[model samples]
Target: MAFGFTKIKSSPIAVDFGSDSIKVLQIVPTNPPQLIAAASVPIPDHARTDTISRMAFVSEALKNLLDTQPFKGKRAILSIPAFQTIVQHMAIPGNAQDNIEFEIGLNLQQRLNINPNRMIIRHFPCINVVKNGSTQQEIICIAAMKDIIMQYLELAAKCKLDVVGMHSEPVCMLKAFEQLQCPQDTSTAQCYIDIGSATTKVVIAHGSEMVFTKAIHAAGEQFNRQLSVKKKVAYCEARQARIAHAHGIDLEASLNNVLAQSQGGSSHVNDISAQAVIPMAKNEKTLGRREGDKDSIEQETIECLIDEVQMCLRHYHSLFPDKQVQKLIFLGGESNHTNVCQQIAQGVRIAAQLGDPFARLARIGLKNPPIGVDLDQPQPGWAVPMGLCMSEANI
Candidate 1:
């Protein structure tokens, strides 16, 4: 029998696979870890419509991306979609890591309602755990379904990238945050939000450990769609207009015309408010009718968003009612959507004690030019990719 199996140090490359785009990042720690290389690849809607086609395009893009970077490492760390994986901390025996993985698989399989054998499990000894309604020393076992896990590895294989260790999106994101802003004081729970085109993820962390995470069903892309359809302009144009609107610019006047042109019961485009369109923003009809039906549309959007946020907070509260979330941070393109943060802050204020948590990185559109755009800092939507890369290596 082979004894003392050789331990292979996992040199995982982090590739962020998203609905609209994909990006790869690599970094090595040795006298201030420097960024090896970064690349952004876009996927068209047609290609993404089918799984097989999408995979093909991604495989091709990955090969090209790797060629450009010429990274020398084989082990790649990848970010799994938060919703697809189950993240929970259970008190398992502080025994061998392998044994704990086996037993934890049994418990989580029952808890997660999945076949026990189908899970890809990993755990690290936690300094403590909750027992008999009290906290005690134990291990933190993170389990993700194997089917989903293998898909990622397969994708890496297809791209000719090495897959070392799999990472939960939230935890990886927390590490990215620490990299961006060296954990201030290291004593408070910091909330991080990542808003993609369709899904938004909120993660709470202390140092590199993620204590809570949640995702919302809305993002900047949807808002752009609302603007694009109504305005008849391209999505890029609408996106620009929407960002301007987020910063409190009154695009209401011309935006009305865009609504007028698009206002047809035939399009099946639901226009909640004449306000969604500004007559001044578009010379032609760019927005739908919001003239008199303000109440229904306004209330519906705000309430839905509020309900979603509260649901996430309630979940975390159930775990530790007394644990106060210090700062609520926001991320993603939509985080810059005007008063979105204020709206979320107000919602949390009513239900729980949400400290002054801001998103990990908030993007402010159009800074001093010549500088081009300062997306490197928090004021821009720079944290997402950085977090995706920085998080892979963090403990």
Candidate 2:
């Protein structure tokens, strides 16, 4: 009952709603986290835009999850898309708790400039403050449209699931880290960057305490867009090109071929359809660039990714400039790159590393069930659901 609802007596599972898919992972804490059951299903591209349709799809998948998996739990924890919401900690003058509430109300009204009536505004006390020769408590504020939140609850209801609590994407992911018993201390800093098809989220924390969170508009699909235009290939074909590039299966010729197709020149004619082989039309696609150069396109894309990482580093440094980042985690499928972590390390002057929270789920007593769905290993895209479950279960 964390979201102003009746408290659930039993621990619920975790349900993560992603842009392209929905994942549910149930963790029953043992010595390490024990995974009771886990299931993942992709939302069709066409159905993703409709909230109602997405809900129906989620419900259908959850039913299948329950029928096929051994996870037996009724309570559920939920996570919201961090990118769609604004989350930041702002400090103001210190005052008594009641007066502070009033002051915070005014401050949010002024700073957020959003209608409180239309938005779901929740504030968590951050750190106690000393300002204007008085004691003031700082709060981390997260605001999202009420409509979006209601839609989720409504969907959950339709699915016959009871949601126990709601958590932010970063928090749930971090909870998954904790379930993993990631080396976290006051001196230890970790940054989790989830790069998806449409956007990338950067969240940094010292140990388990969150320090910074930000979102950039560039993601994996953007990379595919470039390949499509450069190779003049269909979306699926361009996607194949990108995956091949990421896996190191192809090289300059691979890219050169894509570019050749874009220019309407030569055709490889490798038993592929004319329409499928046709080079894509080019559109002005912008990305995070380390240095501005149009010709060095590959480098440009890599640098743009680094630039976003640099921004995350800057935010982390502003809070703890003296400390160094001990670990860097890439969470989304697009983050699968050989030199991406190293490149980020070079750009930010810190050791960058990839992290897998899914592996840690077992350590926290969650069961990793095989439900016949393909799980993209390497990346723990399942972190959110595991996190929500952790939040609901309190471990």
Candidate 3:
């Protein structure tokens, strides 16, 4: 008999097919997970509006990334973009527990006028309620088209990736913060706001159980349009300027001055302190053009988003009258803008902080980190991909 050691199981690659970009991540599941490989590619300007073109672009990008990166194993888990899935809270007959799927299918067919057999449906039981003098269970139903799931699977196959599991973005986002849950304190509710390029997702959790989720259409693309119109610049130019401003490049001179003072042992230098010292430029030239315009255009755009977020909170409050969200943790690509996050926090009137999904992870193989990822700063944008990494595989 030949004796051999069993091979240790490696984590499946976590892929997030975001509207703006496609992010791939793999981690070694150590005590504190360690980053093994990470890569991202932005969707082209021409492909953003076309579904087929976007999928083709993503397929080629994934193939190239996997070929170059040191990703282990061909097995992968991916997130279904929130926009592609239908999430709704519905009340069904109390006796439907044994046939919940059938009831949900019938309800969906009646309300949405779509064939439920063509969709992959899942539900989470919320609470029981008396409706029409009959007890009914309120459940959050998530449905994604079977064709869409097949498309994602086909995309993965094109990249030679074995799709092991798939999940919705909201679920993946919550998984990314699993380590932060306080089992001892179940009364305090928390809200996670993921402001992505296409949409902003609001997820509320009481203790470790998620209770509410909403997706807002107001997000980064709106900010870009606002900036483009206000600055009289091309859409692409406005996008670059918006990114530069978010990274504090527009206030370079002011930040340098603060840095000098900090080095002189004046005070601690952080994002908040730097913002305080550097009066946000009203209008300044950076990256060879005027990039600072947060006072008007940016403020208006963010205010629109804040209003939507407030509405989501109000809806959650109406559902759980006794529970109130005590904290707000901002995530997603657009959350990189501290000014925007600060405004939203102030507008929502909640104690808030930028969520760093990678905070507890030990970064490795980061000599050349992926694009849009700066390990030194809080990466609220990588929340979905990171969360996907922490999730369990189907097989």
What is the C-alpha local distance difference test score of each model? 0.55, 0.62, 0.78
Candidate 2 residues 194-232, lDDT tens each?
Answer: 776666777777677776676677776677777667767
What is the Cα-based lDDT of residue 195 in candidate 2? 72
Error of 3 at 116 (Å): 1.7
lDDT of 3 by residue, 165-282 (tens): 9988888888888877875666888998899988888888877677888778888888888877765655655665566556665544333444455358453323421221121222
Best by lDDT: 3
Preferred candidate (lDDT higher): 1 or 2: 2
TM-score of each: 0.63, 0.74, 0.84
With candidate 1 superimposed using the best TM-score fit, by how many Å does residue 254's alpha carbon deviate from the native? 11
Off by over 4 Å in 1: 1-13, 27-33, 69-75, 87-112, 122-143, 179-186, 218-302, 350-384, 391-395
For model 1 the local lDDT of residue 37 reads 52
Residues 249-317 of candidate 1: C-alpha lDDT, one tens digit per residue: 445533543345445423122322223112122322322223342442233454666677777667656
Which pairs of residues collide in model 3?
none
Off by over 4 Å in 2: 1-11, 49-53, 96-108, 124-139, 179-184, 236-248, 251-301, 361-376, 393-395
